[model samples]
Target: MAHPVDVHVGQKLKQIRTLRRHSQTDIAQRLGLSFQQIQKYEIGSNRIAASRLFELAQIFDVSPAYFFEGVNGANDSEVTPCNTSTTISKALAAIEDETVKTRIVTFIEDISGMAVGRQG
Candidate 1:
């Protein structure tokens, strides 16, 4: 089985790449690797070395910690709330539509205002 860290890293890489509107071929060309290699990295089939990870971080304009956002060094039996929150936050951050963000924020604000009005 692949390591959880690898899976998390791959997901983050894919998300960032997609957000930046980069194709596998583009990143492959920039990294001097084949498109298939990039695909493998994005799918967690390949474990990235520390130096290579740093290079990828540079290429994606993100910190190495970004790839490990949702990972906690916990046993399988232990549930880490931070990891779950991080995963949700990462997904939310990937949303690129400004109008969507504004709508969601306005909806939340309206709901909060209504709750406050009812309480007062």
Candidate 2:
């Protein structure tokens, strides 16, 4: 099984890569690696070393901290990705601003409560 942290990092990596319009081949070639290697890294099947992670951050024009930005406050000790709507993930993937993402989450939570209230 993949570690939760590894999985979280991989998901974030994929989101950022897609948001930046980077092909796996492009990232692999830039890193002198195979596309399969990049796929593995993006799927959490392979763990990225610190140095390589730094390189990826540079390639994406983000800080190394970018990968871990939304990890905390998930109401779980394990930093696994949230189990929400796919729409939410897609929406978040398009946004590079952490503050905006946080606001979106809050908005979703507020609306979700109203949905529950109506259902009840």
lDDT of each residue in 1-120, candidate 2, tens digit only: 887677778888888787566889999999999999999998888999999999999999999988776676665347846445334567777788989976776677677684455332
Worst 10 residues of 2 by lDDT: 80-89
lDDT of 2: 0.79
Deviating ranges (above 4 Å) for candidate 1: 76-120
Model 2 has a clash total of 0
Model 2 TM: 0.65
Please give the lDDT score at residue 50 for candidate 2. Answer: 96
What are the candidates' C-alpha RMSDs?
7.5, 9.5
Q: Which candidate is the best by TM-score?
A: 2
lDDT for residue 63 in candidate 2, whole number 0-100: 95
